[model samples]
Target: MKRILLAALGAISLSACAQAPGGGQAPGATASAPVAKPTVAAAQAKAGTPDARAIEAVRVLNPKVKVERVGAAPMPGFREAIVAGQVVYVSDDGRYLFLPGSGGALFDVQAQKNLSEDAMNVVRKQLLQTIPRSERIVFAPTNPKYTVSVFTDVECGYCRKLHSDIAEYNRQGIAIEYLAFPRMGIGSDDYKKMVAVWCAPDRRKALTDAKNGRGPTNASCKTSVNQQYDVGRRAGLTGTPMILTAEGVEVGGYLPPAALRQALDKLAAEQAPVATAKPGA
Candidate 1:
């Protein structure tokens, strides 16, 4: 099942272009930041099984990397693997791996979607579902129209600005579920402050105060701040105030009350199904 769409990558010379899933390059293209090419010796080092060979072949392209799965890609003559959170295609022969797209951007023109991003979001949604509500500092109305998970830092100016307007956000029926992401990494002052914020009694208030310029005091307890950090990184977090809508689109940085509401509403409308009239009508 892994080999069917049989267009060779690393070259744009092929006459019959296979509609692609994704990959790194077209043949003879220069990689300014070239990935280390996979070696046949490395391929032969693997134990029996073609699937096993394919997996190792993909891995050696970016050695020691963790991938979601190595499976049959939509492209013929290639296999797709979610390596380091993006889609890359490997040749069935265990030799070449690339991202198939024009100007280094992978896409499906017929579908009008970035096939690479679409593939990554599948795993993103799966990871989002695994997050426990208990680990988050949540602010919501009795019933809410939408919920957004935010990866935030108490120290980021934008994050602080967003938190300052928390009440107005909640009033708009936007449930703000916060997962801690201290910008300075674990063990920095900001990170310790976040751990303290998570450990504090009345965590919601503590978080709000920290964001509102109140300093963190001594506190300690078992908490999910570290785990939340890991989750945020895996979900492709590059900075604080990153928000994920229910529909899986990433809303980076801060938005004011009305602006945030507008964004959320737009996303909801986009995901909503169209109404249909009855057959006889």
Candidate 2:
């Protein structure tokens, strides 16, 4: 039932300012000037509105799915909505729906940005915040410069590789917070293993041991593994070793310690507030 709904919301071709594939700005191209926002008249002219029909359409698709906010989509005829924690677009008449996942992305050619990715980043950051720091298995230096949350599966090779370099990451002032994302699904052996690791008296060591093939000791206790996995799903996670920066931008999977540090530095610079002269001083 859920699969059917997701399929109905399957990705649509990038619209609005985006051009056809291979027709827009070349890779590494940057816009010379900021894109102007739509004028009041232009905004009012857009076709779609988050009307009752659009909300009803989404509810019809997934009766139990939570319909959060419904607002203007970048595309002229569609309305963007947060449904069941994922972003989806519905047409003005409420007949069509689109998802920006499974290799499909909504892009802004002129801005050199993935609009869909931007929305997902916001969702990821918000969902991640719901899981308190105490619930995550954290490995960090005494004074870390940056912290990243990783959605990992114990049996994933690259996840193990990332853990193997955990020391180097710490040395580089990068803190890692581990969240369980068992690719094998809930109640599977892998999920049970992660639960055991989370239940261990020493979660950090248990996670490391599991990653290193030492295997998690059999145990059972109150754990947030299920909650973490649900959050990962809502965050649009499709694979393990999914690394997210503090601001919720996914840097990619399995970056080496040095490369990870460089990525973090770049992100920090991008997010840092720019300085302006005070009173022409």
Candidate 3:
């Protein structure tokens, strides 16, 4: 049931940004207050280029899928298109549509995943900003290479293991921002426990101690726990130790600090597409 609700939200988020994929932007949508132009330019770029014929082709196959014109490629002559909230490249003629993923010759599988994140850059940035950094228990480095938002549960073994390795992860230049997501659901004991931690005088310390099996102060007040859980749900997070990379890599479970850094570096490299020389001679 949770999965179904999440899928529905995902669809709605995409449809809300009819011109943009995953609600990054809408057609002719402008801010009422003064905003930077770079933000505007990025929104326009990420919205992609719409191919009416290609969209028609997709609709002819599956009428349920939504299509949007995102943009062109780093390499010329190829217009990037998004179908059903996934990234794909289409020829200038709009006759050939290329679906990117693993197990295919035409598209790079890892690159496809990266492309998905690329298309969602604006959405991730906006979501990140919506949550105030001060509200999070931040484990940061002096010069952090990458930062991740982690949705965690106190009783989960993996979450405990992840907390134990905090020093190692920080040493590897990976900062962690913790969000509460009690697996027992809202209004449960676990949920109340999390609320107590957030309502504590020192949220960061309370979280650390709670993960370490220390008791938290019993307190109650308005908090971001509910809102954070909602965000986690929207991001498709289930269970504990769900991590969101600064570059929009979303994954469940725990990863060792070194492995986590390598994963992030790989994601970064894929996102930064370099021009490759074509064979003509």
Q: For this target, which candidate reaches the highest TM-score against the unseen true structure?
A: 2
- Whole-model Cα lDDT per candidate? 0.71, 0.79, 0.67
Candidate 2: which stretches are off by over 4 Å?
1-101
lDDT tens per residue, model 3, 5-82: 123323432233345346555678985775422211212442233344444444444455565544554445655556
Order of candidate numbers by lDDT, starting with the best: 2, 1, 3
lDDT tens readout by residue for model 1, 1-281: 01111222223434336655656477898879745433332233446544455666554443445555566667687766655555566666655555644423343423334455556577667777777898899999888888998899988999998888888888999899998998899888898889999988789989988887785855778888888888888887867898887655676578897888898887678768999999999
Q: Return the clash pairs for model 2, or none.
A: none
State residue 110's C-alpha deviation in candidate 3, in Å.
12
The estimated TM-scores of all candidates read 0.62, 0.64, 0.57
Q: What count of clashes does model 3 give?
A: 8
How should the candidates be ordered by TM-score, best one leading? Answer: 2, 1, 3
User: After superposition on all CA atoms, how large is the RMSD of candidate 1?
Assistant: 14.2
| TM-score, predicted candidate 3 vs. hidden true structure | 0.57
Candidate 2 residue-wise lDDT at 127? 94
- Clashes per candidate (backbone, < 3 Å): 13, 0, 8
Model 1 residue 29 CA deviation (Å) reads 21
